[model samples]
Target: MASVWAITLLGPARQRRSHNDDDHHTSKEEDIDLGPEPCIFTSTIPAWNCRNLERLASKTVSPLVFAHVRASTEGALADSNCHPFSRGALMWMHNGGIGGWKLGVKRRLVSDVGDRWFEAVGGSTDSEWAFALFLDSLERLGVDADDEVRQRDGFGHVVLRKAMLRAIERINGFIAALPAETREQGDVRCLLNFAVTDGKSVVCTRYVSSRTDEAASLFFSSGTSWKMQPSSETGKGAGKTQLGTGEYKMERRDRGADIVLVASEPLTFERDNWVTVPTNSVLTIHNQTVLIHPILDQYYNHTPSFLRSRGFAIAQGQTAEDRKAAITRENSAAALDGTAKEVAVA
Candidate 1:
């Protein structure tokens, strides 16, 4: 499954530059500061590589940063198809798919977007088109995506949130409009874990557009610092060839979320530091306050203990370990059902 990670540093400004001198030919390094403002960096390369990442990360520290690694089920793998898409001052990333994208819905999805946003689409990914729709929504709401005035004014949390919700609604509407035969074949269930920021505030969501199927796995970890754990104590990578090639941990001295990290899987095995973002909920991080809201739709499930099968998620190329976990969960559910039936007979 696709994964996304973000960090919001809530203090001080730092100076940094891109590692690619040639790529920076069009834009100057000074023009990309995160001081009292938001700046984002995204790469198609797997998170572990991209040498510029370490260089920029080590020097350019900000209160907010986001990263995503994609496992494409609906999109092609290319540099432009990567996450962390930005338009003007808005930076957006998504780790899920738009259900029924291939089955004629692609035309509808693109047609709804405005000409400007439509032209901005660079890659053949549904995710990019989704971003276009988001931009169109913002523009339709009278906040021009490319307007400097709007960027300076800031879209505000309300506008951004509403536009995001509208984007999801539009996708659902398109899926609903599809013929029954097409719907059955396409398996039009969506997993929409998204993160958006303006270098000032961050809003994220963990949602699935199905009542009986699980969304792509998304888990969040927050703490004062994310650091390499003591390898000696954990007996992991103590004798490794590399110095910093060890497992990391989320260290929390207090309840305050100084740094927030969200991903499809826990970056490290520090179980106590991470929490599962409940399905169909939006996790908003505004000024360090984390708020979660349920995304209510026809596919939404209200029951507390209701479990969505993860088989579809696994088949879409989730890690083997995660697939095994889903199998274990299915077995657990089966056993529980058996016990309930026996008790009813007794």
Candidate 2:
């Protein structure tokens, strides 16, 4: 599963007040001094292990957070290859592959990025290069990736969205430029699920470069709080101590989202709480409002009934059901190819 999770807390001042030693502290002063302490906790350990995760999840509370558990189709498994790649005050993560990355596009992708961003890449992953591309795109837009001024001004949502789209466009162009023989022999479809934040606002996308291929799975759950629900069975506990056993729910007393989660798979099996982020949409979380915008490109299809076969994405991470679905799609594609060849001959 190519999953990413993120959360943003609107008011850190109100939260910090409890930690104040002075009883006479003014709320206004605290509010003015409020700045987000953003950090991302990530593990390649299948989202289930790593006892440190459980300890941190229960204790480490932040205004914003991004977590990813990768099922890699392109990169190796190492600590440096983990998601939530950071540079300066900005943190970025991706949940998909750049199409034809190993097919000479890696050279072009790396060549396009400047030395500063290029040096920051510590891992040999396409995801890291994608982040570098994003940084390069920002620089081309006149926003310095390392500039203190832009960091203070905050890279606005528009800047982020533009850079992200450019990154995708560049990847698409790179694939399109590849030799026909190479393209035909390999997959040239891109699944670009990206999440980026400057510790103030978070932006994410669920995208595919092919018009009829499903991107990786991305689901989100938002509400006032994510609490552990009572276990259906009597012997189980209802807290962090219970770990994977206890179920969780999103409590929605109001329309506001005090807590938000985005993941490749639902962290807990609360079906009603999670919603599939539309296949080609950008989800922006600012001031606690979740706005989803469709990414309109040549590959985007407006038809509601159009279904993208999830074969390629599923092949990256196979389950028993996924294996069956992939076989079905492959057989169908083969049959269609045969029919088209016969028609051409006739």
Candidate 3:
């Protein structure tokens, strides 16, 4: 089961896609400006109507953006199991599952959150639970998770980044608290590729709980416009082809990024147009500028030119053709914030 979520922040033309629909074949949306750009729309039907979505996509244009299509690893098929869960102006989504979710990790997570966040979890997936934990972390940090003021004024990218890191830390705590027998025999390393946005700034993380293993795949592309080639040149129609099938390029006429895109995989075969968000790092897209910050934790490996095994991501069908080469940059994880030669992500 895959889930899709999109937000289009536009300076001139902004509209929100609502989750409520009148029927199976029809979709619903509103033109009211919520001051947060738009409401996230999601669907969980096994079959996707690409044409319908393309029609909607063609009509809407955005500036600040985020999206996700999830393949569940630990939940039943249902609408609530989709990505892009929301509360007020905040939207969240996750790729990958909690390690030891079946061994009472989910219970531990639920028990740790407050009553409001706990009762708000509508899905049974660990991904949604992680979102609740994120809201909890924000509240604990003195930021009101449900306050409309923060939503309108923007939950600073730094705030979201710290809360996201703390949420992952809490998740690690849950897995660590599992019984000794469960820990000894279980596959406890988690892949937590997370994305969160409050309609202004965006923050995302590509991480794994193990130092030597790779997390699920995450790639980012930044440029002026995500334009598609003429169908005659690439045999792919522009704006008509669905997300991953379109032949697209990042037109870099200048250094200022007019558009920023992050995906579980590259949407096109354009290699120079995309860069790998270094594993165990946080990527922030604020003011259309991209910043990469390494996640320093116990699972963080600082070995220069260290290679992470692709076996885990491969098993989940998330491997890329140049997967091994993605992390070949010389600077080690520990030196991300220190004195080290910087590697250009684009």
Candidate 4:
């Protein structure tokens, strides 16, 4: 239920870690290069602290960065509960909650995962527990979630996506296995919008457990560069710079997508610059190419224009609506300018 936001940069930049307890402490700063440097940088700060967030942003440099701002819903207000949970080399962020978490899902999920993952949990948030489940999923898929070599070399996108889908399936099973009366008394449907990365590739999902209901809103934007638009003060003086001061838009100079952005909501109000990730689907960004694969299951809705109710997502504090209703045709046309392909994955 915590509202989360993340940004992934595919090129080189400086990486830094800022802790809430050490606001006055000077954290170590290192450049993340393609050769031997660490691949992921994460910053978890309280959503209300604008000054600290600005200070952290000013010193950031990384090709891959995930920033999390926490709004406490299920966990105590503490730094440990802040998101972008990392284990080994993988990072995770979730914008939705597991259905019926307090009823029986929490106890069942805690007992279901392996001991290593269970003990590795550092916080009391269900979001962190979900990350543990994802790590366990990777292990069950014949991949070592903690292997140093694989962590540095990268877990292929295919493997990560498979694990993501498997974890969702397991979550659904937990909800379904609840006592009949408990399931009847509580809302057992899940609104799972997850983002995970192994530092080289990113895989995100916009999924709902009920076929008739829409998933939480997840939008993506891709282009050659996320450039700042011209402003009235540009080129006016030597000391003035408009890089971060002006509005920015996705600029497509070619077919290849040098920049890819996936977020829980449209980063900008420019509707033509964003495209909605279809419901019940997995979106993968690897080597700058975007691929979307449908998550076919009992909850999958095959209709392209299916009108799903937004009541559940709205009540959960995340909005969900039809693409046609949310984005303009020009936006869909702009999406075609990038290198996005949809391949069937059964």
Candidate 5:
């Protein structure tokens, strides 16, 4: 499993705008350090004092936060490769791998996007290129992805959501465009779990291109507060609450969702507090309200009670369990390598 590292924090708004006068909160960039190790130093993470992490988390307060732990499958371990990549206002992070990358999907993705989006790419990961494709998709939709005004005024939830769905559609197009033999070269089945935001509204997806195969793990937890419990273990600091390496839970005093967290896996072992965002669905968070929508496409399985084979997801270490009905479905289900039995539509 790749060690979790990268994080993005959107601070309180710095200026007020009328379009978003409902609550009137501005946004700014707070402290952000992503990667297994910060790039500015001559050392690695183990060399840094653990207290530094505690202090950083304690002092920072942001409404929109994105933390990603990645194991590089396509790109090298450089700081620029750390996700939550941004253009003007849009920021993105992705989990899982792009299928058939080495064959021709990389070339196809690079050639498919416009020059503006192409020039904006700075890293060598399928994730970054996906961001570029997103930017390109936004541009093609007559929405300037880098428009300063839209970046500030909020990129309306519908625009952002549609762009995200289109981006995934574009990815599928590229993969499908490959030669039949080339497509079968590498693992051509993609696990596209993405988190994207325009500072205000957030859109996340848990999708695999195959109808019968499960995508990578994606679980979301929402509550009134993500508070720390009184710990039985204490540290040296007196009267100061310690940020444990493992101690937190979702406390729901009411139905209102004040804080929502989406991760490739659950943040804690509080199973009841978290809900699995359904596969091939989009989750949108606006004004702290979550709405889930199904991404109905050709790969979509219409069976409401269909159980996705978790073998592919578990093999990637994305999920802890293989939740399929029985192991006998291996011949009946889709594999991560892009092989699948025909999906019957109801």
Candidate 6:
């Protein structure tokens, strides 16, 4: 039930040089590849290690970087409970928790997985267990979760996306099978924002299992480069380091996205730089192209005008005010009529 503060950084791959492209005078931003292995860091007290983390990140370069800071709702403070859990080259992280996990879903999910995945769990956390489930899902799709070649090359975006969706489906099934009384005694709805990558293609989800509740807040920014802006840069303002000395900006030198970032919240206060990933949809970042696909299922909101409440997401540690322009007239009317309370911003 912990609130996972996660960040996923995807650096564009090295494009093979083509003779004709050089003659065309096309400028391409290349991500400097320092090594093959990804650099991952996790902490229960990130503030205590901010300087060390920053130093490590400054020197390391990889195609993908996944970082997590856990605000515990469950499990003891330990390294094994930290996220961006990895198996070979595949890395996984979750921002939300399994609904009614303690009520029975955990036991059911644990019992259903094979011994390999079951034994792979080294920590007492829903996030790590969820990763194990994802690995099991990949195996069920006929892909070896630990294949050396696939680990190096990647499991491919299509296969990884399918496995992610299947894992979510299985989680829903487990929650559904809970006894009726148990389900009634507690919230059975899940806020499942998951990200998985094979150091190549990355897939992320912003999903909630209820049609009337918004999922945990997730935002993404993509551009040609993530550049540092001058401190004097104007407007909404740039983000600062803990020392408050510098700022950063997402610079779009061209239409192509050479850098992609996904996070539970906007990394900077520059709201224009980020876009909210639609609820109940999977976002795929492959080959520097960002694609979003709806998760078609029973919990999907078929009505475009329906407004989902953020109350549930807020209670679960994610909060976002619905834009006034996006709220439908019907919902606005209800709010005015006292049927629904207006969301206030201080």
List TM-score per model, in order.
0.80, 0.78, 0.81, 0.79, 0.79, 0.82
Judging by lDDT against the true structure, name the best candidate: 6
Off by over 4 Å in 5: 1-12, 15-54, 233-245, 322-346
Q: Between prediction 4 and prediction 5, which has the larger lDDT?
A: 4
Estimate candidate 1's alpha-carbon lDDT, on a 0 to 1 scale.
0.71
The residue pairs in collision within model 4 are 9-63, 11-63, 13-61, 13-62, 14-61, 14-62
Q: Write the per-residue lDDT of candidate 2 for residues 95-187, one digit (tens) a residue.
A: 778877878788888987899989989988898899999999889888887876556456777888888888888888888888998888777
Worst 10-residue lDDT window for candidate 3 reads: 321-330
RMSD of each: 7.2, 6.2, 8.8, 9.7, 8.9, 8.3
| lDDT of candidate 6 over 58-81, digit per residue (tens) | 776655667666577557877678
Candidate 1, run of 10 with poorest lDDT = 337-346
Q: Residue 137: error of model 5 in Å?
A: 0.5
Task: Write model 4 residue lDDT over 120-173, tens digit each, in one string.
Answer: 999998889999999999999999988877777788999999999999999999
Clashing pairs in 2: 3-264
lDDT of 5: 0.74
Steric clash pairs (candidate 6): none
TM-score of 6: 0.82
Better of 1 and 3 by lDDT: 3
> lDDT values of the candidates?
0.71, 0.73, 0.78, 0.77, 0.74, 0.79
Which candidate do you rate higher for TM-score, 3 or 4?
Answer: 3
Candidate 1, residues 268-326: lDDT per residue as tens digits? 86677778877777777776677778888787798888866776666665322355566
Q: Residue 72 in candidate 3 has what lDDT?
A: 63
TM-score of 1: 0.80
Residue-level lDDT tens digits of model 5 in 120-159 = 8887989989888888888888999766677666788899
How many residue pairs clash in all the candidates, one count each? 7, 1, 0, 6, 4, 0
